[model samples]
Target: MPHPNFILLYVDNPQQSAKFYAPLLDKQPMESSPGFVMFALDSGMMLGLWSKHTVEPAAPKIPLGGSGELAFAVADAAAVKALYAEWQQRGLQILQQPVSMDFGFTFTAVDPDGHRLRVFAPYDPAL
Candidate 1:
Protein backbone atom coordinates (compact mmCIF):
# COMPACT_ATOMS: atom_id res chain seq x y z
CA MET A 1 0.00 0.00 0.00
CA PRO A 2 1.21 3.52 -0.71
CA HIS A 3 1.73 5.68 2.35
CA PRO A 4 1.46 9.41 2.66
CA ASN A 5 4.60 11.45 3.34
CA PHE A 6 5.32 14.50 1.28
CA ILE A 7 3.49 17.83 1.79
CA LEU A 8 3.44 20.16 -1.15
CA LEU A 9 2.45 23.73 -0.38
CA TYR A 10 1.58 25.83 -3.37
CA VAL A 11 3.18 29.24 -3.00
CA ASP A 12 3.36 32.38 -5.03
CA ASN A 13 7.13 32.36 -5.00
CA PRO A 14 9.03 29.22 -4.20
CA GLN A 15 12.21 31.09 -3.34
CA GLN A 16 10.47 33.49 -1.01
CA SER A 17 8.48 30.73 0.67
CA ALA A 18 11.68 28.74 1.14
CA LYS A 19 13.33 31.73 2.76
CA PHE A 20 10.36 32.36 5.04
CA TYR A 21 10.24 28.79 6.29
CA ALA A 22 14.01 28.31 6.65
CA PRO A 23 14.45 30.16 9.93
CA LEU A 24 11.16 28.98 11.41
CA LEU A 25 11.92 25.42 10.42
CA ASP A 26 15.61 25.94 11.29
CA LYS A 27 16.70 24.12 8.14
CA GLN A 28 17.71 25.21 4.70
CA PRO A 29 16.05 23.99 1.59
CA MET A 30 17.53 20.74 0.37
CA GLU A 31 16.52 21.60 -3.18
CA SER A 32 15.50 24.88 -4.74
CA SER A 33 14.75 26.25 -8.19
CA PRO A 34 12.74 29.03 -9.75
CA GLY A 35 9.60 26.93 -9.52
CA PHE A 36 10.21 24.67 -6.56
CA VAL A 37 11.93 24.15 -3.24
CA MET A 38 12.11 21.16 -0.93
CA PHE A 39 12.99 20.73 2.73
CA ALA A 40 13.73 17.72 4.86
CA LEU A 41 11.93 17.80 8.19
CA ASP A 42 13.33 16.27 11.34
CA SER A 43 10.58 13.64 11.30
CA GLY A 44 11.68 12.35 7.89
CA MET A 45 8.83 14.15 6.20
CA MET A 46 9.33 16.14 3.02
CA LEU A 47 7.91 19.64 2.60
CA GLY A 48 7.83 21.03 -0.87
CA LEU A 49 7.17 24.55 -2.07
CA TRP A 50 5.76 24.60 -5.55
CA SER A 51 4.97 27.66 -7.60
CA LYS A 52 1.21 28.36 -7.46
CA HIS A 53 1.00 28.92 -11.18
CA THR A 54 3.25 26.12 -12.36
CA VAL A 55 1.91 22.73 -11.30
CA GLU A 56 1.60 20.76 -14.50
CA PRO A 57 -1.37 18.94 -16.06
CA ALA A 58 -4.04 19.28 -13.36
CA ALA A 59 -2.75 22.26 -11.41
CA PRO A 60 -5.48 24.39 -9.89
CA LYS A 61 -5.67 28.01 -10.97
CA ILE A 62 -5.46 29.13 -7.34
CA PRO A 63 -2.80 28.26 -4.79
CA LEU A 64 -3.35 25.11 -2.79
CA GLY A 65 -2.58 24.16 0.86
CA GLY A 66 -4.11 27.29 2.25
CA SER A 67 -7.25 25.70 3.63
CA GLY A 68 -5.69 22.91 5.64
CA GLU A 69 -3.66 23.31 8.81
CA LEU A 70 -0.17 22.07 9.59
CA ALA A 71 -0.16 20.82 13.16
CA PHE A 72 2.67 20.31 15.64
CA ALA A 73 2.16 18.39 18.84
CA VAL A 74 4.23 18.98 21.93
CA ALA A 75 4.75 17.29 25.27
CA ASP A 76 2.44 19.55 27.28
CA ALA A 77 0.55 22.79 27.47
CA ALA A 78 3.64 24.71 28.57
CA ALA A 79 5.37 23.75 25.38
CA VAL A 80 2.40 24.96 23.41
CA LYS A 81 2.52 28.32 25.13
CA ALA A 82 6.25 28.59 24.59
CA LEU A 83 5.94 27.95 20.89
CA TYR A 84 3.06 30.39 20.63
CA ALA A 85 5.10 33.16 22.24
CA GLU A 86 8.11 32.38 20.12
CA TRP A 87 6.21 32.38 16.86
CA GLN A 88 4.45 35.57 17.87
CA GLN A 89 7.81 37.20 18.53
CA ARG A 90 9.00 35.92 15.18
CA GLY A 91 6.16 37.91 13.60
CA LEU A 92 4.03 35.12 12.22
CA GLN A 93 0.44 36.34 12.13
CA ILE A 94 -1.41 34.93 15.09
CA LEU A 95 -4.83 33.55 14.24
CA GLN A 96 -5.56 32.30 17.74
CA GLN A 97 -3.80 32.70 21.04
CA PRO A 98 -3.05 29.69 23.16
CA VAL A 99 -6.21 28.54 24.88
CA SER A 100 -7.60 25.57 26.71
CA MET A 101 -9.53 23.18 24.55
CA ASP A 102 -10.93 19.68 24.68
CA PHE A 103 -7.75 18.37 23.13
CA GLY A 104 -5.54 20.49 25.40
CA PHE A 105 -3.91 23.77 24.64
CA THR A 106 -3.42 25.07 21.13
CA PHE A 107 -2.56 28.16 19.19
CA THR A 108 -2.65 28.92 15.51
CA ALA A 109 -0.64 31.10 13.22
CA VAL A 110 -0.68 31.90 9.55
CA ASP A 111 2.16 31.75 7.11
CA PRO A 112 2.92 34.39 4.52
CA ASP A 113 0.47 32.75 2.19
CA GLY A 114 -2.26 32.41 4.86
CA HIS A 115 -1.81 28.72 5.54
CA ARG A 116 -2.63 27.80 9.11
CA LEU A 117 0.07 26.41 11.38
CA ARG A 118 -1.24 25.00 14.64
CA VAL A 119 0.65 23.92 17.75
CA PHE A 120 -0.93 21.89 20.48
CA ALA A 121 -0.04 19.97 23.59
CA PRO A 122 -2.42 17.53 25.14
CA TYR A 123 -3.57 17.95 28.73
CA ASP A 124 -2.93 14.31 29.40
CA PRO A 125 0.54 14.08 30.90
CA ALA A 126 0.94 10.53 29.75
CA LEU A 127 1.02 11.67 26.19
Candidate 2:
Protein backbone atom coordinates (compact mmCIF):
# COMPACT_ATOMS: atom_id res chain seq x y z
CA MET A 1 0.00 0.00 0.00
CA PRO A 2 1.17 3.52 -0.62
CA HIS A 3 1.84 5.82 2.33
CA PRO A 4 -0.59 8.66 2.66
CA ASN A 5 0.98 11.90 1.49
CA PHE A 6 -2.02 14.12 1.66
CA ILE A 7 -4.17 15.15 4.59
CA LEU A 8 -7.46 16.94 4.26
CA LEU A 9 -9.40 18.77 6.91
CA TYR A 10 -13.09 19.55 6.64
CA VAL A 11 -13.53 23.22 7.41
CA ASP A 12 -16.35 25.71 7.70
CA ASN A 13 -14.76 28.05 5.16
CA PRO A 14 -11.76 27.29 3.02
CA GLN A 15 -10.76 30.91 2.52
CA GLN A 16 -10.84 31.66 6.21
CA SER A 17 -8.98 28.48 7.06
CA ALA A 18 -6.42 29.23 4.34
CA LYS A 19 -5.80 32.66 5.83
CA PHE A 20 -5.35 31.17 9.28
CA TYR A 21 -2.94 28.49 8.10
CA ALA A 22 -0.90 30.22 5.40
CA PRO A 23 1.20 32.35 7.69
CA LEU A 24 1.37 29.71 10.40
CA LEU A 25 2.64 27.10 7.99
CA ASP A 26 4.65 29.71 6.06
CA LYS A 27 3.19 28.49 2.81
CA GLN A 28 0.69 29.98 0.44
CA PRO A 29 -2.12 27.91 -1.02
CA MET A 30 -0.98 26.27 -4.22
CA GLU A 31 -4.61 26.01 -5.18
CA SER A 32 -7.68 27.84 -3.94
CA SER A 33 -11.31 28.13 -4.88
CA PRO A 34 -14.54 29.03 -3.15
CA GLY A 35 -14.73 25.74 -1.30
CA PHE A 36 -11.22 24.40 -1.36
CA VAL A 37 -7.60 25.33 -0.68
CA MET A 38 -4.39 23.36 -0.86
CA PHE A 39 -0.89 23.89 0.53
CA ALA A 40 2.31 22.10 -0.25
CA LEU A 41 4.40 21.50 2.84
CA ASP A 42 8.20 21.29 2.99
CA SER A 43 8.04 17.53 3.50
CA GLY A 44 6.24 16.98 0.20
CA MET A 45 2.99 16.37 2.03
CA MET A 46 -0.09 18.16 0.84
CA LEU A 47 -2.57 19.77 3.18
CA GLY A 48 -6.02 20.45 1.90
CA LEU A 49 -8.94 22.32 3.39
CA TRP A 50 -12.36 21.59 1.98
CA SER A 51 -15.71 23.08 2.83
CA LYS A 52 -17.59 20.68 5.08
CA HIS A 53 -20.88 21.26 3.32
CA THR A 54 -19.51 20.69 -0.16
CA VAL A 55 -17.54 17.51 0.34
CA GLU A 56 -18.86 14.66 -1.79
CA PRO A 57 -20.63 11.81 0.03
CA ALA A 58 -21.03 14.38 2.83
CA ALA A 59 -19.00 14.51 5.97
CA PRO A 60 -20.25 12.95 9.17
CA LYS A 61 -21.69 15.32 11.75
CA ILE A 62 -18.75 15.40 14.06
CA PRO A 63 -17.88 18.34 16.30
CA LEU A 64 -15.07 20.58 15.10
CA GLY A 65 -12.75 19.23 17.71
CA GLY A 66 -11.67 16.07 19.56
CA SER A 67 -11.88 13.92 16.46
CA GLY A 68 -8.16 13.83 15.72
CA GLU A 69 -5.13 16.06 15.63
CA LEU A 70 -2.49 17.14 13.11
CA ALA A 71 0.83 16.91 14.88
CA PHE A 72 4.14 18.65 14.08
CA ALA A 73 7.32 17.17 15.44
CA VAL A 74 10.15 19.44 16.48
CA ALA A 75 13.69 18.93 17.68
CA ASP A 76 13.49 19.20 21.43
CA ALA A 77 11.67 20.30 24.52
CA ALA A 78 12.93 23.85 24.12
CA ALA A 79 11.57 24.05 20.61
CA VAL A 80 8.21 22.86 21.85
CA LYS A 81 8.26 25.51 24.58
CA ALA A 82 9.35 28.18 22.15
CA LEU A 83 6.58 27.39 19.71
CA TYR A 84 4.04 27.26 22.52
CA ALA A 85 5.04 30.80 23.45
CA GLU A 86 4.92 32.02 19.87
CA TRP A 87 1.53 30.42 19.23
CA GLN A 88 0.26 31.94 22.47
CA GLN A 89 1.30 35.37 21.25
CA ARG A 90 -0.46 34.66 17.96
CA GLY A 91 -3.61 33.74 19.93
CA LEU A 92 -4.00 30.08 19.00
CA GLN A 93 -6.54 28.53 21.38
CA ILE A 94 -4.38 26.37 23.59
CA LEU A 95 -6.08 23.21 24.79
CA GLN A 96 -3.03 21.78 26.53
CA GLN A 97 0.02 23.48 27.94
CA PRO A 98 3.53 22.19 27.31
CA VAL A 99 4.13 19.07 29.33
CA SER A 100 6.13 15.87 29.14
CA MET A 101 4.03 12.84 28.38
CA ASP A 102 5.15 9.26 27.88
CA PHE A 103 5.68 9.94 24.18
CA GLY A 104 7.36 13.34 24.52
CA PHE A 105 7.07 17.00 25.38
CA THR A 106 3.88 18.24 23.75
CA PHE A 107 1.06 20.72 23.61
CA THR A 108 -2.22 21.09 21.73
CA ALA A 109 -3.88 24.07 20.14
CA VAL A 110 -6.95 24.51 17.98
CA ASP A 111 -7.50 26.21 14.65
CA PRO A 112 -10.41 28.51 13.92
CA ASP A 113 -12.54 25.61 12.73
CA GLY A 114 -11.60 23.78 15.93
CA HIS A 115 -9.21 21.30 14.36
CA ARG A 116 -6.64 20.23 16.90
CA LEU A 117 -2.99 21.05 16.17
CA ARG A 118 -0.29 19.43 18.21
CA VAL A 119 3.44 20.13 18.52
CA PHE A 120 5.76 17.64 20.13
CA ALA A 121 9.35 16.56 20.59
CA PRO A 122 9.82 12.84 20.43
CA TYR A 123 11.02 11.23 23.65
CA ASP A 124 14.78 10.88 23.84
CA PRO A 125 15.75 8.94 26.93
CA ALA A 126 19.30 10.21 26.74
CA LEU A 127 19.69 14.05 27.35
Candidate No. with top lDDT: 2
In model 2, what are the clashing residue pairs, if there are any?
none
- For model 2, give the 10-residue run with minimal summed lDDT: 57-66
Question: For candidate 2, lDDT tens digit of each residue in 59-112?
Answer: 999976738999999999999999999999999999999998999999999999
Alpha-carbon lDDT of model 1? 0.86
Q: For residues 1-127, could you state the per-residue lDDT of candidate 1 as single tens digits?
A: 9887899888889999888899989999999899999999999999998887787764655544446888888998888988888898888989898899888889989888878898998777675
lDDT of each: 0.86, 0.95
TM-score of each: 0.90, 0.95
**CA-RMSD of model 2:** 1.2
Write down the worst ten-residue block by lDDT for model 1: 57-66
- Which number leads on TM-score? 2
